[model samples]
Target: MLALSAVHETLGKILEPPTLHTAVIFTPAGQLVSWQSNPLCAKDDVHLVIGLSGDAWQGAREKGYGMVHHNHLGKILVVPVEDVERKPGEDKPPLMLLALNATDEMEWADMQVKGKALGAALTKSWSKHREHLTVPKPPQSSVAILTGSKRVTTR
Candidate 1:
């Protein structure tokens, strides 16, 4: 799991623009990881935005536009956080960064640059932290059966 504080700090820096209302880190499947907003946006709203972004992202790819594509929403910018350390054909999904309310060309440009930096930072953190991820092993035990008055092990 990525550090929430670190993610928020990176997002906070990107949300420097007055028009930029919110920034979210989420998967292409709409799982929100982290977010930072200027006026305290709701989690539900963030989820909705991410969902729309995911659809737009998919549409863009389907149209052969590539990962980086501007959606019809106009104000939202979805940037893909690609993991450089990941091997080819790896099943790991890349994270997406979405910024809300980039009204003009300059703001859009600003978001693109800052969003890329945030993506790179997040990818690095995710790659580093993933090394420490561990799965819990199942417990090993002998099966017990009660016949009449005694317990018998059936391992």
Candidate 2:
């Protein structure tokens, strides 16, 4: 089972290089699970993130896509991690909210790639390790990337 530390580590590594400012992993009810933020971020920032993400999550559910928003501050993305195949009466979260705040517009483009990658990694990792971990970290053991039409699987 993975630990919270591992989840934070994965988020740090993924957001640090891309100049992303902050991220919060929250539940559908807006409760925080984990987060990583630069020194510039404040606790209030987290609330704003959750508020935006919660609304976006609802929209995403209706539209059937990840939610990305641009604002004067930068960009915000909310992604839901849900298990469609789970049985009834489970204790798992309905969906997790992943909210990101980038530093600039250019970083938004970079975020799309890294954000989706992070979402995918977390979704897979969490489902596999949820029995013991509050949140899942990206795999640290091996790295894989797509090379051709064959398609690579990392989950």
Candidate 3:
């Protein structure tokens, strides 16, 4: 599993000055996996941003924008943490990065460089701890097959 401190340190190195109010790693379904916040940040604000940002990212993809590697939405920055080994046309990744700025001071150029670094770190973490991080689904029920009036259950 990725350490919370490591995530905090990486987020800290992304932007300076006004500083980031909060940063979070979440699932495609909008479940928060991990987060870090500055002393001045409110937990409610962080949760709200994560929920909204997850929706924004999903909307972008559904609207034919394709996978948005990074988005600069005023005071918010959303970046997808993609698997480097993913093949074309595969399902969308399960994790994303969302950062809330103290103000609308984040520059696109700066964010590109820093966001990639943060995303790469997250990707590495994902690859290393994929089994542990993934949510386990219940086994599927057997399907019934009818052949020549005989019914058989098959997995």
Candidate 4:
């Protein structure tokens, strides 16, 4: 499991003014894994990150940029915590989404640098504590499979 204090310290070292209104790590499915935020930050803000992350991820993959979007609330930057260069036969690492509620003061250059730094830190953390992080179980869904004239249900 990721320590809240570690997250705060990492963000503090990277962002301008070294403050975090909201910092969260979530799964691809928008499951909140760990977070730290200021008093002004609402838990509901996580929903916003979830929304931003999904879109930004797609946009970034398409455009090949680091900082995806910036709005009135803050900026959204996501980096893959996984090491994509794994050895053959090794399972691919899970990506940890890093979303920050950073204000405009953090310019594009600064934000890109911070995003890389944060990604490095998180990648290390992910490797060290891979088993500790929560792995959301896949939702059980009944799938219908046809066998000749019969229908079978499988989860």
Could you give the C-alpha RMSD of every candidate to the true structure, in order shown?
A: 10.4, 15.7, 9.1, 6.8
The lowest-lDDT stretch of 10 consecutive residues in candidate 4 is 61-70
Q: What local lDDT does model 1 show for residue 132? A: 43
Error of 3 at 50 (Å): 0.3
Better of 2 and 3 by TM-score: 3
Error of 4 at 75 (Å): 1.9
Instruction: Pull out the clashing pairs in model 4.
Output: none
- Point out where model 4 deviates above 4 Å: 1-20, 62-66, 87-93, 128-155
Model 3 weakest lDDT span, ten residues long: 64-73
Sliding window of 10 residues with minimal summed lDDT for model 2: 129-138
Native-referenced Cα lDDT, model 3:
0.60
Writing each residue's lDDT as its tens digit, candidate 3 over 85-155 gives: 76767774545555444455555456555555777777876765655666655368867668998998888
Q: Cα lDDT of model 4 overall?
A: 0.62
lDDT of 4 by residue, 1-155 (tens): 66777766665554343344566677755777666665446767767876786678656743333354546567777655665454555544356677666776666566656666777777875666655664745456866678999998788
Residue range 87-120, candidate 2, lDDT tens digits: 6666555456677777664455566677767777
**lDDT, each prediction:** 0.62, 0.67, 0.60, 0.62
Q: Model 3, which residues run further than 4 Å from truth?
A: 62-74, 100-102, 136-155
